[model samples]
Structures are given as structure tokens and as C-alpha cells.
Target: METTFVGRHVEIAQVARLMRESRLVTLTGLGGVGKSRLAHRVVEESVAEFPDGLWLVELACLTDPHLLPETVADVMGLADQPARRRAEVLAEWLGPRRSLLVLDTCEHLVEAVASLVDTLLRAAPRLRVLVTGRQPLGAPGEHVYSVPPLPVEDAVALLRERAGLAAPPDGSGGEGGAAELAELCQGLDRIPLAIELAAVQLRTLPPTVLLRRLNDRYHLLTGDGGPVRHGSLRAAMGWSHELCTPAERLLWARLSVFASGFDLEAAEYVCAGGPLPAGQVLEALTGLADKSLLQREEHPTGVRLRMLDTVREFGAEWLSRLGEDSAVRGRHRDHYLRLARRCATEWPGRQVEWYGRIRAERRNLRKVFELCLADPQWSRAGLDLAGTLWFLWVCCGMSREGRHHLETALRADPGPGPERLRALWVCAWVAALQGDLAAARERLDQCRAEDPEGSVTGHVLQVEGMLALLRRDHARAVELLEEAMAWHMAKGGVLSGLLPCHALAALGLLAAGRPAEAVETLSEGQALCEVHGEEWSRAQMEYVFAWAGHVEGEASGALRHARSALASALGFEDLSLSAACVEMIAWAVTEEGDAGGGAWLLGVAQAVRDSLGLPRSGSGIFAPVREQTLTQAVKVLGGAGFDTLFAEGQGSDLGIAVKYALGEKIS
Candidate 1:
């Protein structure tokens, strides 16, 4: 795949045409038949046709078919915060968008994939799915396109390009060479993978020698393979495996445990020791890459490696034979468990980097999450791990996904412990955020019942306060929030909750129409945040302060505080908080006498909420401002003028809008 793509123009065109006439297109072929590459090529050619953009979900990394929809949701950047099923969330979010979703490597999960595709298609009428596998998904209206092996000329060209040779020794730049190369491709069955595998052996063996070796291997495979095209690819793959050193072979088998491409540190830790030796993993990894059995990709963090699915399957078969599947999986799980804890520890300081790091490893983390939840022995670890990821799920707009894992863990282990107690509170927190008051209360009740001694006193109080505020019970909310803040002050707060308690209490105070007291509470919270060098909670407090100032009828002062909060929100990149700040600024703008500017900000806020599927702040504390601002703008500028300005805001890039709102020069 590192080399230039040599063929498949016809197939790409055919698939492109199929897409125009169909919603589901399945590219089916034999192993190593280039279906995945072909699917990507087709999407690239017609990408501009879809307005919602193209998303490629690599299904080979998934071990659990049940996660099919979650994987799709993750790829689409949909914040899975709603308490509904993941497929429902995906359907609602994608229903009105024109998008192309490519699900790659579906041979193992055809049934699940088909079921998901059926549901998604029924709900999201404008959505299109392109699938790649050895067989069809068989969903309604699915157009099946059989990806063929490279034809004669393209096969020779591919082999020659992959080998990087001017001419084969047997062909010497003439009709003789053309005949020789064609026959070589024919001997390898003209399959792209088979030809590529054969090309690598040309480094040490001449064309004639490699051809003879391939023919011998092909005939030997004929007994079991029975003249199928797969026999040719299998023969080449076996030869490639034989080319690898024993250590490299063993490393390949162990590396198969990684759900996705992994960095060198992961491979060294998971695939080391025993006969392979820890110190030699890198050397063996390099050997596999040199033989074209695995690929190396350069990333900003570091170099990561991955093998093709065919190669990974071959290694998996070897691993099954060696009976180290359980041991390797255990090592993989333990490594990620440690990494998850480290991510949680580092998130306080590296909020921005934390988001990037977790997203890069999300597929692997999901696999680990599923493994632990599925096994009773690992259920407790799952409970703790799910709770530990509260920041990722809540702050990152993935609250729905967070709830998914937590619900699974909570169901798997029902007992009395600090882990279960903390998980209950975290689940309730997200549930309330999504407007599921009943579920939120149920989880909170569970939390209290499980921990009779109240180990998570502050956590429970804060969520109760949040739920009350969302329900517009201002007096009760204020009282509960005060208790949470007092407990936080007494015990010295923990990450996200300690200082955030002040922000939650401040919001409750604002809801109760007490802006003056809210300021006093936020001042102390902001100072504590500054002391800890934390901006996430500090930004939240600033956002609450801006709203409080606005509620107290101080337009300019509230704009100042809101601007500062918006800058910080942009830095940390929380969609919901950023939208809240934008909405606050709109209120300040209208109060300061710029009705048109306020209208534009309203549009931007609406766009942000729609794009990320975020609900209103505190369930609707500022909800009245939206209508009031729009009415004022329409009265001052007329319906047509207001519409034009509002549309501009909707069309403008979010970063530019933020800069515009901050009074910075827009270039």
C-alpha cells in the first residue's frame, strides 16, 4: 500500500456509478483482493458530492460485533451523550445530513453490519454506506460489486512498481521481458496482494527463482485451496511468512493482539519476552516491515506499525496454534489499563493533548472496555476504568458513549464498593446532562443505596444540584449546591469535581436569581483553579460569572468575562461550554445595543449546538434570551435583513466567528 496505486480505475468508476443509484454498496472479493483500497479510492473520487463529508470506519480493528454502531458513531464524531441506543443516536444525528460512510473489513461481522445498515438506512434516508468484505452484507437495496484481481497488464505493472525494478532478469527490457512479467503475474494468479508479496522476494531472489518458488507453493496449496484465487494469495503469504525470521514471526503473532495500529512502546511491552526477547522486538518489527508483512506509519507522537488484515489473520491463526491468545490478550488489557490511569492523571494539566491522545487510542480502549465488561473476573476493573474516564465522556462531548460503557459495567457487577459507588454518580451526572431526569435520579438513588456511608458525598451532592437546576427548582438547587461546595471545601476537592463544585453552585445561584452571591462563590473557585494551574474548571467558573453579570444587568462587564471564558473554551475545545459562552455574548451584545450583532451570535450558537447535538445550558437558564434577542433583531432590522445576517453567522467558520466576537481583526 505504500507504493503508488497501479490499477482499479474501471472498478472505481463502476463503484462510483453504483453509489449514485444506490444507498448501500458492497465491494466483495477474495482475501487480499484490494476491496478496502478500492473502497477508499471510490470515496476519494466522489467525496465532494456529499456535504456532510466522508467517514471511513475501519471494522477490522473491532473485536466485538456489538460495537458496530458505536464504532460508526465514533468515526462520525457524533457525541453519543443521549441515553438512547447508539444506533438511534447515529440515526438522529445523520438523518438530515448528506454523508458517505465507508465501513471497511466486514467479513467477520456481516450479520451485525447488515443489521446496523438496515436500521440506519431506514432512519437516515440521506445516508449512504460503502462496505468492503469478502462477501455481501445482503441488506435491502444493497448493490454488490465484486472486486476483481488485477488483470494481466495492471498486475505486471503493479509487480514491477512494487519491486522498483526497471526490468526482470528473465525479461531484459523487451518482448521477452513483457512475456516474462505477464507469465509471472499469471503464476501468482494476478491478485494484487499475491503480486505484491511476490514483488518483495525479488529483493533477494531473481524473477525466475521467485516464479519457480511461487509455482511450487501454489501447487502444494492446490490440495486444500482447490484452484481458487485464494490459493494463489495464500501461497504468496506463506512464502512471505517463511521469509520472516522466527523472532519476527513470533512478534507478528503477538502484535495481532493490538486492535489498531500501535506505537513501538506498546509492541515492545506486549509482544516481548519468552523466546522472542524484550530487547529484540524492534529488530523483529523492522524485519517484518522490510518483508512487507507489516507497515510503518510516521505520526507526530512517534512511529506506529500495523499489519494488513490478511497478514494479521495469518498471525492470529499462528497465535491460536501457539495457545498464547489468552496470555497476549491479558497483557494487552493490562497495558491499556495502566495507560488509561496515566491519561486520567495527565488530563488535569494536558487537557488539549489528552483529547488527542485518547481519540488516537479510542478503538483500542473500546476493545479493552468490552473485554473487561464481558468477563466477570475483570468487571471491577471495568467499573473503575469507566468511572475514571468521566472527563473524556463528559468534557469531550461523548457523554452518550461514556454512559454506554458505564451502563455495561454497572450491569456486569452489582455490589457494594467505592468503584461502583463512583460509577453510579458519574452515570447520573451524564444522564442529567442529557435531560434524563428519571434515569439520573435512579442512578443517584443507586449511588446512595450502595454507599450508605457516603464516600462520594460531594459527587452525589453536585449531581443532585445539577439535576435540580435543570428542572428549574432554583431554591432546592441552591441549597444542595451549597452543601456540595461546603463538602468540597472541607475534604479538599478531587479532579473535575473539587473546583467544579464552585461553578455548579454558581449556576444554581444564578438560576435562583442571586447573581451577587454567585460572584462571591466563583471568585474563590477561580482562585483555586489558578493555584492548581487548571483552566477547564476556571473557564466554567468564568462562563458562570459572565452569565451572572448579564443577569444583574451589567452588559459590558459580562461581555468582558464571557470573552475571557470563550478564549479558554476554544483552547480546551469543549463544544457545549463554547456554545454557552457564545450564547452569553449574544445576550451581552443585545443589551449593549447591537441587535444585529446579537442576531449573528445567536445563529452561530445555534449552529454549534446543532453540529454537536448539545442541549441548552442548565436545561434552559438562558433559553429565554434566544427568543428575546431574535424578536428584538427582527423589530430593528426587519425579517429579511435579520435572516441574511443570521445566515452569515451560520455559514462562517467557528474560529472566525469567535475572533469576530472577540473584536479581533478578521483577515
Candidate 2:
């Protein structure tokens, strides 16, 4: 567990000096050449110079560039506000603070990180950034530092340190041992990661034997006198890979299917089959980790293994060469598909836990989606996968990405089936959330054409009802939702549409000026969810229940329901529903004669919407209510008092806003 940085003092000092002189310092080098390690050393030495302290944002697990700003803000402990762009908020927060922001692994998201860094440097005069990647950010006035591999002496020293500890004391340390270690480092091109990997082998192999096997592997792999850095690194990897038992090599290649780190169970599930039986996966995985092909780390849930991108690429190449790439990819896709289905199925009863699991595997799901859509044969499966993840996309605020993948899969595979029908309806839901009613309608029409009498008819009807509600056709919306609910109740299958049907029906009834009926409908939905142990749609039903109570002059009851809804929505990260709950709480408070509190809550709702990148449309079920609340609040609090309260709400944290909505006094 004690990992010591070896032989980078001069590089670290030089980088530290460069950072002090430059606003942005980018440490660029080949993979496994120790760029990340050097950056860590430099930051460790230089962090005390900044008053605000140093912050490291690891980008290796981030797959979506669109989330870069939000990710950074989250790391900086910024609350999600719906009223402003995350990037603008982040810049404002960092503007007066003197700190160093270290962005690790920017190569995959170079453009996003560069753009963000550019904006931050312009807005935050006192802020500096340090980036580690295979390439430079190439920003204005940026300083690029190329990290070279360790010199022979330092490489030997690192090897000796690791080897000395790992090797038996009596079996190590002689002039011959030193010579063999030096030759091994030379063969590995002095790359610190490669050297360390080779050093660990000394635990099992003597220096002489290790060097001989490495030489044999290098002779078999090297050709054409390639660049020393590239050839040596590749040869070292090949040697290490060759050292693995056949089962271990198979697992190593299969592990490349994962886009991020995974635990043992996941590896066993996805990579175990044929030559590598499920029973042997753990042993093979441990073997690979022992040889440093897989990096193991402890997580809150369990120990996870990760392959460096470079090593993964090598394994992937071998996988393709062995012609098992497609087979392994199929298994990978199947495993994640099962995972998504499980999350969706369990989300109702275990909302928070399922949400976290889905979030953790989001990258792998993306890879599954990509692989499925890229092949015509698997296009239907891709559509099914995308449709199944509708909850994660719509309720979890991944509307944009959900739309992208859905649209791609839809375009690629227009073949008619139950999967396509489901995808069409899911696509419509995403479109409706984005305010593209035309697109939503078009997709619904396509679903209807595909199978008006099929199982997806209920979902299609629910989507139509949603569109009707958004367009203010409340009566028609209610009728459609009721019909969908009845159809789903009769069907009673695994893909039953009960949740969406009930939730939308309640909203439709509420929108039609029938609060009493809406309350009854929501109660029915709540009872159904409770019977089934589902919570996903219950949050939205709770919001509508709050509005129903508010309409019926039950202010205290409305406040209770609103708070409950907000808590559930926040638990699931359902931003839109949370904002609606806030608005409902504001309405109730205003009705109770607390106009100042109501105005502030209203402002918080606006901020939440702004942070989520949702536009304020003049039409909707709550638009008139919102207008009335704002007018009443302003009239009671007066213009000056209202502005002050609104400003306070705008700057308040989301948690504070929630507490205020629940009638807690602010400190």
C-alpha cells in the first residue's frame, strides 16, 4: 500500500517552477511514461503555495464531454442550480479564489477540458491549472512539458527498490543482480510503469530468468526498427502479456470490454466462458494483477480492477487478432444490458441504490450502446437497451444523451418489432422533455404505425397523454392516460405500463382543474406502487398530490407532500420533479400568507430550472399557478423586499432551498 515515487525529483522541481511562471501547465507524454505520477509529485510539492488549496479532478472515468463542467462543479462542491449555466457558475465561484486545479487524463476530453480551462483562465485571474495527458491542451499562453522516461540509473534504482522488497532477501543483491536489472530497464525503454511492472516479477522470477524471458519476447515482437519509445513499451507489454498463463491472457483481453474499472463479480460474469471457465476467473484475474497487467484498487463496494488505457489497447488488439473480439463484445453488451434491465426493474423499490448502480456503470452502458448500434445485427438489441434505460435518461437528467443514443439506434434500425416500438415511445418521451412536441408526436406516430395493438400501445398512449398535457389539452390528456392505465392493468406483464400510466394520469387530472380527482388518482398510483414496492414514479405522483392539496386549501398537507416529493426526487437526482415540488411548496407558503418565503422558494425553483438547462415555457400545467404565486408574493412582500428575497434564494445552496421549502428557518 506504500507507493513511493521514484527518481522524478528534477522533473518535479522543473514542473513546479514552470507552473509558478505559467497560468496553465500541461504535462504531456506517452502513456505509461509517468506523466500522471510526475504531475502528482509536482502538485504535492506546490499545493501549499495556493491559499485556496489544490484540487484534483480525475477525468479517467468521465465519458461524456457535455458533463465536464458539471463534474468539475460537483468536485468543487458547487450545488446544482437550474437558473444558470454550470460553467458560468463555476467561473464565478473560482474567480476570486487563488487555487490550482489539476485535471488528470484529459486526452479523451481534450477539447472540453481545453475550452473549460480557457474560460476559467479568462475569468479567474488568480487561478492556475495543471493538466496531465498524452497531448497538450494547446490553449493560449499554455506551457507544455514533455515528460521523458527515466534515465538508466534511475530506472535501475526504481526496479531495485521494487524488486528488493518483493524478492527474497537472501536471493537478491549482487553485481550480477544489478546488471540484470539494468538490462531489463533498458529493454523496457526506462518507462517507469513498465519498469515497475517488470520489477514485480522478481517476486516469482530471478533477475536472470526474467531478463532472459523478456529478451526472447522482445525478439519475437520487435520489427522494422520502430521508434525506441514505442517499440520498447510495446515489447515490454508483450513480454508481460506472454508471461501470463493462457487463462490469464484470455481474461486480460476480455477485460478490455469494460470502459472503466469493474469488480471481480463483473469480470467473472462478462469474461468467463470457453477456455476460461467461470471457476478460474478469480485466479486468472489475480495472476494478471500480480503481473501488473491489471491495476487493483479498493472501493467502497469491493476491490476493483482497472487496465491502463495503453495496456487495454494492447489486449484489445490481441483480442481482435484471436477473432474473439465480437464474441467477447457480445458478452459485454449482454452483461450491461442485463444490468440496465435490473436497474430499471428494481428502481421503483430501491430508488437510491439503483440510481447509484446505474450511475456507476454509465460508461459501460455507453460502450454497450455504441457496440450494439455499430452493428446492424445488434441494432434491435441496442434499441431495446436504450428504451429500457428511459428512466435513467428522463428522470435522472440525461435527456440529451438519451436522445442521442435513441435517435442513433432508431435511424440505424428501422425494422419493426416490439423493441423498435418501445424505442419509439422512449424517444418520444425524451423529445417531450426537450420541448420538441413535433418530434415527440412524430415518434409516437411511428410507434402507432409499428404496432397499435402490441404491448407498447399502453406506453405510446401514455406518451401521447404527456404531449397533450404539455400542450394544455388537459381533458384529452386525462382520457388518454386513463385508457393507457386500464390497458396496462389488463395486460399485467413484465413490461407493464402501470407506473407511467398512473403518474401521467394524475398529472392530467390535476392539469384539468380537478384537484379532488387528481388526489384520488395519485392515491391509487401510490397504493399500486406500495403494493409493488416501486418508487420511481411515486416521486412524480407525490408532486401532483402536493399540488392537489394546495388547490383544495390544505396548506399544511400540501407542504408535507411537497417536502416528501422533493426528498424523493433529490434522492433520485430527478431535477425537474424537484423543481416542481419547490414551486408547489412556494404556492402553499404564499397561500399561507408567508409571501417572503414564497418568493424566495419561487426564486430557488427558477435557479434549479436554470441549472438544469431547461427553458421557461409560457404554457404548461403549472405556468398559470406560478404566475399567480409570483404576483401575489410581489404584492405582499413589495418590489424591494421581493428582489432581496429572490437574490438570497438565487445564491442559496440547493439543500438550503429544500430546508426552507419545508419551513425550516435559515441560519
For all candidates, the clash counts are 3, 11
Report the C-alpha lDDT of model 1 over 1-667, residue by residue, as the tens digit.
Answer: 3667788888888999999999999999888888988888888788899976589999887877766776786667544446356676567656666888999999899999998898888998889999999889889999999998888888888887887767546555632377777888888778888888888886667777766787677676565543454778878887887888899889988988888889887888889979987899889988888888888887656677888888887788778779999999899998888888888888766777777767677778888988898799999999998998888777776776788888989999997788899899999998876678899999999888878787788889999988788777888888988888788778876565778778888888887778778889899888887777677788888888887877777889888988898888776557677777887788788888898898898888876666555563324655765666688788888999889888777656666898878878989
Give the top-scoring candidate (lDDT): 1
Candidate 1 structure, TM-score to reference: 0.91
Residue pairs whose backbone atoms clash in candidate 1: 80-400, 81-400, 171-177
lDDT to native, each model: 0.81, 0.79
Off by over 4 Å in 1: 64-67, 83-98, 115-127, 167-176, 215-229, 570-573, 592-594, 611-618, 639-667
Query: Across residues 363-387, which tens digit of lDDT does each residue of candidate 2 receive?
Result: 7887888788778888888999988
